[model samples]
Target: MEALNKSFFLFLASRPSLDRFAKRWGSKFGADKIVGGETFEHAVPLIQNLNSQGLRVTVDHLGEFVASEAEARERTLECLQSIRMISAHDLNSQLSLKVTSLGLDINPELVWENMIQIMDEAVKHDVFVTIDMEDSSRTQATLDLYKALKKKYNNIGTVIQSYLYRSDQDLDDLNEVKPNLRLVKGAYKESAKVAFPDKSDVDHNLKLLIKKHLLNGNYTAIASHDDAIIQYTKELVREHGIAKDQFEFQMLYGMRSERQLELLAEGYTVRVYMPYGNDWYGYFMRRLAERPANIAFALNGLFKK
Candidate 1:
């Protein structure tokens, strides 16, 4: 399964055609199963439903790397409008954005401008914004923007991937500001030179990072489904005397329903990352890559018909 998982990641990075298969499956399953939407009008009902279930949500815009400043600015506005809908609906949801999607690749100034706009709007709505970490190539730039924005905005946060060797240092630097962090085991195609290639190493880092956050940070979000990791985190929280609401446990909506609900029922703050958008291929493929069992289940569902 490990070899197959690695091969699937390589295939996703190199073979464009495999995306077609992912797209077909995504179309059948529908976008709401993956991401929110390009517009809040389409995402509000799902967001409201999750909020009703005692779960908080983080909305992601889902596109990345616009080549022109104008395009990026438009996406930024779309995100702002989404925030307005969240406020209107009175939902406990926050916006999660990718800097690349806001034009980081175009010009740093454009990225900063768009970020400032979104952060300002988020503050107006009392909504928080989480800057998602992308590939290693963009990590430094993302961290820089996050730190700068954190200095000016009252409700801005960032994500860190434990799969990278540098994340320990990133956590230490972020400690100076005591920023809110969402820690994930990374979900990108990365090389061994920069990212840990072994699953055990990644899992180890995840546990270590979680322990550090519970012991030292103001607030942290543990975002993973590995049962062992989840159990260890529960133990660490107890050992450190961290209150249930001091941190949150986040999981992808469809990946681990039972575990997420169990955590919530056990009095821990839980958030479901509800992704919905037209571009479901990339998102769905990553889900399959994360666990071959998901792919097998998907394939079996198709064959049964």
Candidate 2:
């Protein structure tokens, strides 16, 4: 059953046509429960609502892996506008984006150019942009893009997947810059050669990365839904006398709402990673792949009495 769930969700993540169909006609399946909506205009209120609850937000547009420069530019422009709007609202929201969404696959140079323009816009608004780390294939380019841009702009940040085998060293190499990192338990399908295949190993690595960042005094966002990880982090930092401002916790938009609010109430900053856009298929499938129980959530909607 575990293998079946893994394979089934991965199959969905790999199917773009099915994703498109679901995006167009599958609202009843609980996509909105996770995704913000179809546009920036639609996502603002959602972000505002979370902010009202004392939770910060990192808004992401639901698209990645563009096949053409035109599509990549289109996504890039949307992100630039998002930064402007986020600033104008004075809302407690930042921006996150995928490298592949900016044409990394088509051409790394083009991706870098587009990313620079977006970062330029982010700086004007004083809004930080986080370059989301994709799968292993593009991790090098993602790091390269981040290293290149961090030298040019101080307002930029990027994610580091804890599942990768080299993450410990990656963090060390990036320590000189005091990298602002969002440490995620990686959602992509990865090979054992390059990644920690065991969940236990990934969890350990996640905690290790968190500890290193805090020890180095770098601002880190611990993105996870696991109770043990969160509690362990809290205890670790408490034992080390780490201030609340030193690090923050991040959760996806639709998961663990009570915990997000509870963390905020405890005076810890919690950022909600909220995604919205017409191209939500890929994002939704990836979510399902990461948490197979999400498939059951969708099925419950379909089979509700």
Candidate 3:
């Protein structure tokens, strides 16, 4: 039953027709709770509020899978604008974006050019940029781009999904860069040949990756909502005598609000992954697919206002 729910939402997430319909409604279905806003400007005050509460933030301009160079360029400009805004507002925030939105599929050269523009602005503003991981098929290409960018910029980071069979070795490969990584138990649906087919395996692997990455002495962002995972991290860091500065906790905005605050109160750095923009349908569906508990708020959103 749980698997069926996941697969159903995943299928809904991929439908262009549904995506179009969602845009017409404009974040009406509880998506406004998870999504920051339809634009970065609309999200500015929200970021300020989170910062005031001592919670750091990373804002993603919600979008992906661009099919045109023009669209990709537009995405790049949005990212550039976001960096400048983060700096101008003096907000405690980082920038996160999907490479596909910047022409990863349209053309590599185009994507690289777009990335260089965004990276230049990010560096100038002293804002960190993290390249979000997509599905299994694009993992290597994403990592390759990240490695190239890492060579040129020190304020860059990328996600590593523990569900993938290749992630363990990918960490070793990335260790050379001393990467600042946000470790996640991936969201996209993937074949068992490439991803662990069991939730237990995925959870166990996440713990292992967290341990390996932290002990590797790289900056680690342990992104999870599970209490078990949180407990494991606390015990592991304490046992290893790891410094608090070496790692932090990350959670999607509006999902684990109380836990995020508790962690912050406990002196742990907690970053809220707040995504803004009109292209929110796909992201919203994925959040529902990730945890059925999210559907409650989503349903609540429907009758709201």
Candidate 4:
């Protein structure tokens, strides 16, 4: 049932007409509760509010998998604009971008060029840009892009998903520079050949990865909402004497506010991942895929509408 739910929503997200319709009507069905908002004007106040609460944020302009240069360029520009907005408002947020949204499918070089533009903008404001990892298919290409950027900029970073078998090696290969990382228990529906087939194995690997990085003295983002994983991370930090600045706990915005505040009060840094844009159906669906319990909220939003 869980696998079916993920695949079903992802399939709907791929169809152009259905996606267009969702982009128009999804919020009425409760996407608003998950996605921060549809525009900067709507999202900034929310970022400020979260900042006021002692939680920093990583802002993503909702988009992915562009089929053409035009779509990719439009999406890239919006991300650049998001960076500028974050800086202008002095919001305690940075940029998180998906390469596919910037034209990885159209051409890797195009995506690289778009990245350079966004990275340049982010640097001016001293904000870091973290490249969000997608499905297994793009894993190698995404790493290639991140490595290329690593030589030129320290202000950018990338994610490593524990569900992928290659993540341990991938994280190790970066030891020379110890690039900053956001570790996530991936969301995309993936195959057993490329990803773990069991949840227990994935959870186990998540702890292993977090422990390895934190011990290495690298900046790490523990991006999970699972109570077990979060609690284990806290224990690991205590044992290693890892200061709050060395790592942060990241959760999706609006999903775990009380927990975020509790972590902050405990002196650990907490960052909320917030997505904002008209292109939101796919992003919201992925949130549902990650936590099936959210479907109840989505359904209630639909019924109320």
Q: Indicate which candidate wins on TM-score.
A: 3
Instruction: Give per-residue CA lDDT, model 2, range 1-305, as digits (tens).
Output: 65466657777878867876786766777788888898999999999999998899999988888889999999999999899889888888999999888999998789989988998898888898899998888888788889989999998889899989989999998998889999988888888999987778998999999999999998989998888999989998999999999899999988779999899889999999999997877677677766666778777766665
Cα distance off (Å), candidate 3, residue 186? 0.8
| Candidate scoring better on lDDT of 1 and 4 | 4
Better lDDT candidate (2, 4): 4
User: What are the TM-scores, per candidate, against the unseen true structure?
Assistant: 0.93, 0.96, 0.98, 0.95
lDDT of 1 by residue, 1-305 (tens): 67577567556645567666655565454334456654667788877888887888988767776778888998899789878978988989988888988999999999998988898899999999899888899999999998998889869889999889999998888887888999899888888899998889999999988888768856989888788888988898898788887789898865677777788899988888876555556666666677666666556555554
Off by more than 4 A, model 2: none
Of the two candidates 1 and 3, the one with more favorable TM-score, higher being better, is 3
Give the clashing pairs for model 4.
none
Ranking by lDDT: 3, 4, 2, 1
Candidate 1 vs candidate 4: which has greater TM-score? 4
Error of 2 at 180 (Å): 0.4
**C-alpha lDDT score of every prediction, in listed order:** 0.81, 0.87, 0.93, 0.88
For model 3, how does the per-residue alpha-carbon lDDT over 5-96 read when each residue is reduced to its tens digit?
88899999989988788988756787888888889999999999999999999999999998899999999999999999999999999999
